[model samples]
Target chain A: MTEQIAWIAVDWGTSNLRAWGIGPAGAVVATAGSDQGMGKLAPQEFPAALMAVANQLALPDEPVDVVICGMAGARQGWLEAPYLEAPTDLIALGQGAVHPNMPDERLRVSILPGVCQREGGENVMRGEETQLLGLAVTAPTYAGLVCMPGTHSKWARLEGTRIAGFSTAMTGELFELLKTHSVLRHSLAGDVNGPERDGGFLAGAQDGLDEPEKLLGQLFEVRASALLSGRTPDWCAGYLSGLLIGTEIAANRNQIGTDPVPLIGSATLCALYARVLAMTGAAGRVVDSTEVVLAGLKAARASIA
Target chain B: MTEQIAWIAVDWGTSNLRAWGIGPAGAVVATAGSDQGMGKLAPQEFPAALMAVANQLALPDEPVDVVICGMAGARQGWLEAPYLEAPTDLIALGQGAVHPNMPDERLRVSILPGVCQREGGENVMRGEETQLLGLAVTAPTYAGLVCMPGTHSKWARLEGTRIAGFSTAMTGELFELLKTHSVLRHSLAGDVNGPERDGGFLAGAQDGLDEPEKLLGQLFEVRASALLSGRTPDWCAGYLSGLLIGTEIAANRNQIGTDPVPLIGSATLCALYARVLAMTGAAGRVVDSTEVVLAGLKAARASIA
Candidate 1:
């Protein structure tokens, strides 16, 4: 019954879980995802949850060769795979795997290791490892800065198949904290997106990156001026967005180190990052790295085959 | 009744509404506080909510003098008292009271203004304004730095009876967010206190304040290291506490202007701030500001009386 086994690939992130079923040639057959993100799932429950998705593909309980990526490989997940330090390369990933609850009856499952950063000091990245691998493949013709921007924006320096180094900025998370928890929330109007919104976000981002020293002090004005002087809440969001992302852009202008950085992520997300990057006079091209995740998944599956 | 009317005091904060029937000598004859804090009550409900407490004293409904100093007068409170700007004196406070539902109600209620700051760029402080006022009164000779520590740590500079400037750090809120919402919660062991545990709080605080340039980049390590390394979860609090307090301390080191900052707050809270302060070679003194809040309440009440 071994007619060259099909491919199994999964992307397990903090808030999302995506799985794909591919033919022998890495052609997509079926795909599935659920709100059962790694952040919310119980340790022992990952197997059953995975099987539920496999069932959706009608692939039965037989665990062909499944390769997983993201935070799922952290100590809290199915296994405690350590991160590879920066100046990391593809071969630096080594062979990492997590034996889930259904292990005895399982066919095969391998979880990828994330990156452990120790430049100025210690830092980490889990799911981005897979994204980087995908990035390397997708950007093969292109060699420069490959960035995956999200809650923690990641920038990877890749040459050929090797990931030279990577850095992260808590841009999105800071934005969330400032908006929801900080006093800045009071000044910001609820919605950040609308039609009458006269291009406030990019402008805010520009101003933020320009003057970071004034960042912490100006936070009050965003709210006060909005309340007292009637600044739009959208502007507040844009201003805050600017402060976080702009601070990141300014601080890492050297680490990211390039004239043009290729932003590789979902369309909307890449746009957001690109907008911030635009302020630095950095050239940016939005590339969809989704194919790379699937490609990396296929490559990982092929290794076992 | 008139003779006993020494000081009518109130601690009208966010989640709890409290009023004390103080004698001319500032002694509590009757104390009443309700779940009817500003957070729980609507703007229109302030009259009835406050009246419910005053009714307990059998005090006349039409006119009674009270000096309130708490979250009650915050922007989110029943009445939005204007924020007192930095480098401000008590005289700089906003005029007019938060006329409760009762339009002509003469139960003279003077809600103090929260502090407004424009340092570096952010604005913060509310409940601390009253405490700062109390500190000036109680520590008549005390000057330099006064830190009112809590979920949000407020660092203020008091030049005699006047407040020069202050800043609010989201240190406490960070602790809560990381412990409850972030990945750190999973491997977390315990608090930053106890004989077996000083936790990592002090160390974290020191680390945070150590260097301002590298502050934001180092935040993720607190959680990541605690999980991957032998760092305890209880230390997570300290690590976070250090980052926040440390950052504030470093940023305001100039504003604190090379002087031993004395912490003025409740005994327990003062100790915590002092412990962190000690690590920085900055001496600290705990002044029981509860009495000062009462005193400030008294003085405020006397003015209207």
Candidate 2:
């Protein structure tokens, strides 16, 4: 049964490593993940980490072609896979993949290159490029705005198979920093649930969309609201989340059109972005991130083959 | 010489405390400070902390009035000195001062109340209100916008002696959090100085003032600039500082008039604000925080007398 293992697909990022074992028909047979992300590994240690994850699948005697994407190919990662400058052809992403020198004979590893926009204020994306590639492969004729929400949320303008341009927002990172480290942490002490959370989120999103410029001034209101109006910690947390997400959407509002934007990310995050998008009289639909990354990996594998 | 001590003025904040002993003519005769801030002490323990700082002055046998401001007057501090709702009369700020019962007979402590805005938006200021009062006392007829930059930078609109309205921006706190804890920390590793620092700061300030609404999208550019262009850590730090400050100023730009804005706080911080304000085609003058606070305490003392 293990002999049916055709090749491997991996999405190795800064904080986590996810690998999928695909069969001959381009379907996932086995899947594995670990906390051994690029941030925690030295260049030499990457081989062992990859092997450990692959060993769980019980590979055959023959070597397996492993198509890897993300920070694993960063300058500080296993081997530097230099970025492909935008506007890059998503289908041709595999043309820039770099083969890292792996000691294990069974692992034929090719790390995909990220996309960099050097001309327009210097922006780069590693794993998201593959996901964008996956989006391109999944919907061959798709074109418009695609939103991928995460620690560094990216919004890309896709024209056919080409990524014309894109921008990254530190919304998720800022929200986490404010929640865990800032003075607002004292006010946002509890977890929120139910209608209270929903109402707070919508109210905050409205404020953010209405006056994104006044975000700095309004942030202190979280503390002030807690102190003076007795707003609960749950409300504060929901409001902060909505405010950041809303502001992120508002910043990119000009690019958004009448068509439903395809949000490719984790279900939870995409749902939040979708809700915020709806408030702007725009629509969004969540596309499974794992599915697209796998499709993207498969496309890269086919290109290399 | 110690016998000439008339009263004491103290600014007890979240992380630090400072006390000044006044002589017969209302001049600073002695000064002392400690890390025993209101945040560190229990309500009962506040008396001991105050005594420790006052003991440095070798107080006379007679009872001494201790005038306090800042977080020491908050509901969570030594005693809950209720906030005086805005539009508050700056000269009459002392009318809301609360006295916590002291164990030592010689300590006659009066904690000044903070000002709160409940109508337009939830906003509050503690120690800065006293600085506003000090500004009022020093320039009795002067009326304009006063900026106090700190952990929570404040902007107050002064209509003669009355505070018409004000707003708070979490600019300083955001800068610290992003520099120390966010992903930007990796790119901003070293201290910057001289022309490069100034240049980076001005460039970032200009961008921030020009398009404050796009701040969320622009934050990631810091990291991108470092990765693509090999920008120095000094440049990154200076740029981040300027960007946040500039955005803060831009948010409050409508309130700023042709008059030179008065910046009150630590010299270094106020200087940064002044530079950013200048970038907006407005002038700023740094006011000595200590002198103004002393004058504000003196004004409060006069009110009590």
Q: Which candidate ranks first by TM-score, i.e. highest?
A: 2
Score candidate 1 by TM-score against the native: 0.80
Q: What's the lDDT of the predicted structure labeled candidate 1?
A: 0.66
Question: Could you say which candidate leads in lDDT?
Answer: 2
Residue by residue across A30-121, what tens digits does model 1's lDDT show? 88888778878878878877777766665734447678888678776766667777766663353554545464354466787787766555
TM-score of each candidate? 0.80, 0.97
Task: Judge candidate 1 at residue B216 and give its lDDT.
Answer: 49
lDDT of 2 by residue, A241-262 (tens): 8888888899889889887999
Model 2 Cα interface RMS deviation (Å): 0.8
Error of 1 at B189 (Å): 5.6
